[model samples]
Target chain A: MIILHHLNNSRSQRILWMLEELELPYEIKRYERDSKTMLAPPSLRQVHPLGKSPIISDGEVTMAESGAIIEYLGQKYGDGRLIPETGSADYRQYIYWMHYAEGSLMPPLLLRLVFEAIKSKPLPFFIKPVARKIADETTRQFIAPQIKTHFDYVEKFLGEHEWMAGHKLTGADIQMSFPLEASVARGVADSYPNITAYVKRFQERPAYQRALQAGGDYDYA
Target chain B: MIILHHLNNSRSQRILWMLEELELPYEIKRYERDSKTMLAPPSLRQVHPLGKSPIISDGEVTMAESGAIIEYLGQKYGDGRLIPETGSADYRQYIYWMHYAEGSLMPPLLLRLVFEAIKSKPLPFFIKPVARKIADETTRQFIAPQIKTHFDYVEKFLGEHEWMAGHKLTGADIQMSFPLEASVARGVADSYPNITAYVKRFQERPAYQRALQAGGDYDYA
Candidate 1:
């Protein structure tokens, strides 16, 4: 049996969706982010020392990192379902989107979150404008352009293919979901119709709806 | 023929090392970062719209993301060399380290670089101290602690195994090389002897030397 250590509204949701899609039997041990910090609770460290979510344990094997988990689940229980066959062109594309979701796409989005948090932190009235200026400038100069580039690249891919990797809805789409959902939450979705449509299609899945119900509240969608 | 589109002192160097280790015939197309911005040159966008390093083209396959490229090369050329056999404990561990290198490890390190750059930027004299305070505070409160956790985790793993996955030096180690090397360059290596030793072990290898000679001017080692 697979035990998913899930954090509500985090990347863990992607794994839950995958389990549902793959029809794998699994149990979820839910975690909640601290309301103030919006960070995962220390309770998660017991599951894995990294204290991050989207970790799973199957028998003696426990693992962390969403892409790793996605790949492992896809390989083990997927029975060749959500991933393209090895040595195929679609397989190469699948690997790119799966890794790209976390490797390249999430960094700038995460920085934007951190900067926004910094800007909203309680500060002396006098220094508030200066902090705001720095945060806004960093977002404008560094984060926004990179985010645009990534989304544009993703949009172009979605324009050509029904799914991220190719014609099939695979683990790449599941892995890519979080960043794109977060992008929608950040109000950048309107500019990219294909991405918006992609997210919509995922949400419309009965399996996805089941995962959402099981995974708990996710404001991003 | 395999073509590696390398950027100086970037993650792309990891691919060069992999190519050498696999004993594959490959050519390098090196792109220098802009002297002022220290970002990948616009020329890279011509290869892939993401304009990132560590991209490669094998025949018609053009791909980016280090983990993806590592997995692709490992599957296509490895012949069960740099990666473990499928459905094994080692393979699961291999996947974790490969994705964790970029997904979890690189983000904090990259943030540290960005914050340092922001702190050093030419700003009005009066605002400079404020900027430094912000950067230092973010480093102290957020980035530094996370980085320490990651290093601690890596150290624990290396303490157990010679390589990232198991007894073998697999593509997982190759994927992990960049972040560990960057940690050393940033002067954090002293805190984690295992990681330092791991980097040293890889550096001593002939393939690594060959990669360094071909890749050019990586100060991290």
Candidate 2:
């Protein structure tokens, strides 16, 4: 049996959407992040030592990391359905976007997040001003443009075809949709109209709606 | 035929080693990072816009990202030699280690680099002493122990087992060896004897030497 340990308003929304896309019946084990601190609670460590989200168990094997989980599921349960078989051009493109989503696309956005939170401290400590400068400079000077550019790149790629990978919906779309949506949620998506339109199409999918029902209140807040 | 677009003293070292481990004949097109800035030169952007190293072109397909390239090579040429066949426990473990090398293990160390670079910069006018306090406090309080703790995890894991993927030297070893040697080169390995021993074992391999020769100065710095 496949089991998904999900966290609401977090990356697990992608996993849920993936499960729906695969039409794979699975069990959901939900956890909530600390509201005031916006941190994952210590109780999550009991699920896995890493104390992170979107962990899955298949048979007896359990693992953390969202990218790994998405890759594993595509390999294990939905090989024919969600993943492309190896060696074909389609398969190559599938694998490329799979890695691209986490590898090339995410670092700057995440660094931007950490860069911002460290600056949110009300009192200007010895470290506060520097943190604020890095975040402020980064968001305006580097990160915002980069995120918009990557989103535009994705939009142009999508224009050439339908889905992120190809004509069919593959796991790459499933994996990428969450982060793309989260960017919109954080208001960064407003600058990329192409991404906004693409995301709207993503929302219209019944599978996406089903995932939201299972996963709970998720939106650009 | 395999073609590697490489640069000296970069991640290309690992890719070259991988080709050697597979005993595949390949051509290297090399680039040098800017001596002044120590960043990959803009010339690399001609190959891929990311301006990163360790890209491989096998026939018509070109791939970037070290983790992706390693997996691609393992799947293509080193199937029996490096990675396990698809749908096996060995294959599953191989995937885990591949992701772990670049994702979980490398991030924290890289984060330290970012923090240090922040400190290395001249403190802005009026905030100099505070920045020093933050940098000093961070180095003593967090970075040192966090690094030690991470390496210790590797040391203990390696101490009990012959290799990272347990009993055998699979592609996981090749994937992780760069970072392990890197930790050593960066002065993080001295504290972990078993990790040092493991690095020695890796260095003793003839194939590793060929890869190092191909990579020029990189060969684990």
Candidate 3:
């Protein structure tokens, strides 16, 4: 049996959906974010030292990091179901998106979030404008363009391939689901039709709906 | 032939090291970062849409993202030399480090860089203190502790294993080499003996030395 250490409203939701898609029997141990800080609770540290979620333990083996866990689950339980065959061209693309999601894509999005928070964070009245200016300038000059570059790249990819890897659904699609969904939920992806539709197409999956029910109150869904 | 789009002082150096380790014939197409902005040159955009470093092309396939490319090179040229056997416990750890290097680790380090720049960035005399304060507070409140948490976790792991995955040098070690080296180069990792020694251990490799010569002027080494 697989035990997923799930954090509400985080990337862990994708793990649940992956489990559902694989039809694997798993139990979800939920952790909530600190309401004020929006950081994962300290209790998660007991599960994995970093305390970030989407960790899974099967028997004696424990794992963290979504891309790794997704690959693990796909290999251990998937029996070659959720991933493309190794050494195929699509397999190459599969590996690319799996790493690209959190590696290449999320950093700028995370930076954008940090700067937006800095822009609005309550400060001494005199310091407010200065802080906003710094945040706005950084966002305009760097963060925003980096994001646009990524989105445009993803949009172009999706325009050609039905899924991230190829014609079939693979773990890369599951791996990519959270970031794409979050972009839509955050209202920044309305203009990218392929991305918006890609999110919708994944959401409409029966397995996705079941995972949503199991995960509970996911913000990005 | 593999052609690496090498970028100065960037993660692409790891790809060069991996190529040398495999003893494969390859070519390097170096792209210098803009001296002022420290961003990859526009020429890179022609290779990968996002214009990121460490992109590689073999035959007709061009791939981006370090972890993905590392996996690709290992699979294509390694003949089972650089990775653990699939589905083993060590292989699981190998995959974990591959993603964790860039996915979990680099973001906080990158954030620290951003905030450090914000603190030192030239600003109006009136606003400098306020911008610095915001940057300082965020570093104190969030980024610093996050980096510490990740480094501490890595330190504990390295204490137990000679290599990142197990006793042998796998692609995971190659994947993790950049961030660990950069942390040392940036002067934040000296306190962690295991990390420092691990960086030294790999740097002493003949393949790594050859990579240094081929790479030309790597800061992290």
Better of 1 and 2 by TM-score: 1
Residue-level lDDT tens digits of model 2 in A1-221: 78898877887888888888888999998888888867677777688755667788877888666666777888877758777777777777776777677666776677677557557755456567665665576468656766765777776776677777667888878767766888877787777777777778888899988988998877542
fnat, candidate 2? Answer: 0.15
How far is A11's C-alpha from truth in model 1 (Å)? 0.5
Which scores greater on lDDT, model 1 or model 2?
1
- Alpha carbon deviation, residue B46, candidate 2 (Å): 1.7
By lDDT, the best candidate is 3
User: Residue by residue across B76-122, what tens digits does model 2's lDDT show?
Assistant: 77657777777676666677777667666776666566567656766
lDDT per residue as tens, model 3, B1-221: 88999998888999999999999999999999999988899999999888889999999999999999999999988898889999998899999999999899999999998999987888888888888889999999989999999999999988988998878899999999988999998789989999999999999999999999999988777
Query: Deviation in angstroms for A94 in model 1?
Result: 0.6
True contacts kept of 3: 0.95
lDDT of each: 0.90, 0.75, 0.91
In terms of lDDT, the poorest run of 10 residues in model 3 chain A is: A160-169
How high is the lDDT of residue B197 in model 1?
88
Candidate 1 overall lDDT versus native: 0.90
Candidate 1 lDDT by residue in tens digits, A1-221: 99999998788999999999998899999899999888999999998999999899899989899999999999988887999988888888899888888899999988998899889989888777888899999999999999889889889988988998768899999999999987877687789999999899998999999999998899887
List ranges where model 3 is wrong by over 4 Å. Answer: none
Best by DockQ: 3
Which sections of candidate 2 miss by over 4 Å? Answer: A125-131, A138-149, A219-221, B135-153
